[model samples]
Target: MRVTQHLWFEKDMQAALHCYISLIPGSSLDWQTAVMADNPSGPAGSVQMAGFTLGDQRYMAIEAGPLDSFNHSFSIIVECDSQAEIDRLWTALGEGGSYEQCGWLRDRWGLSWQITPKRLGELMSHPDPAVAKRVTEAMLKMAKLDIAALEKAAKL
Candidate 1:
């Protein structure tokens, strides 16, 4: 059995997918094609579908005109091994997008993403409740997550 995360975009599906695959280390566009048969979503050739992979995950997306808007209900999370990686992706994905508190942001395409350091999870899972609480507080105050600052908070 196979399950893929399917996305519906009103526009810019290919551009968004290409940009997204470039950001991830082991990602690619598996296939893309335009529909020729008439369907409710479009007059026929207007619909476009593509399958892709981000790391080991499979995803399919369609450009079938506006059926609905992307919202907070769905988000993609990228956990980085270093602050530099987090910073890089944060800048790339957050460009021309809306920034939200605690490592959350919406890209120009209106897709939400979480760019966070892997260390954040380790610190949050610390045995001491104070450590976790401190980390949480620090994260809440920032639009982008900082590993150094979070570690310092956990130490306090």
Candidate 2:
């Protein structure tokens, strides 16, 4: 069985798909289709559905009109191996978007994402409770997570 995450957009399904696919490595747009008949959402030939992949996970999107919208309750978490990786994704994804505390940000499309460094987990889960607490405190004060700052906090 294959499980896929589906997203509904008011319009610009193609642009959104392309933008998303370009942001991640090993991602691609698999297929897209336009409705042949007039639908409630739009005229015929409008974007009906599109399929894409982000790092091996398949996703589908539909131009279902503005009946629904994305919320912060759901977010895609990208785990980065290093600070550089996190910085790249954070800057790119946060373009025309708002940054939130603790590595959270809302993309231009209103999709939430957590561009975090893998070392964050290690620091947050240190053996000593004081170390973990320091790391957590440091993280709480930042929009984009800084691994070096977190490490320094842990050492204090």
lDDT (tens digit, per residue) of candidate 2 on 1-156:
999988888877777778778878899999888878888877898748988998878998898778878887778888888898888889988889889999999887788899888898898888999999999999999999998898899888
Model 1: residues with Cα > 4 Å off, grouped in runs: none
- TM-score, one value per model: 0.97, 0.90
All models, RMSD in angstroms: 0.8, 1.6
lDDT of each: 0.92, 0.86
Q: Scored by Cα lDDT, where does model 1 land?
A: 0.92
Q: Taking the candidates one at a time, how many backbone clashes does each contain? A: 0, 0
Give me the displacement of residue 109 in model 1, in angstroms. Answer: 0.6
lDDT top scorer:
1
- What is the TM-score (0 to 1) of candidate 2? 0.90
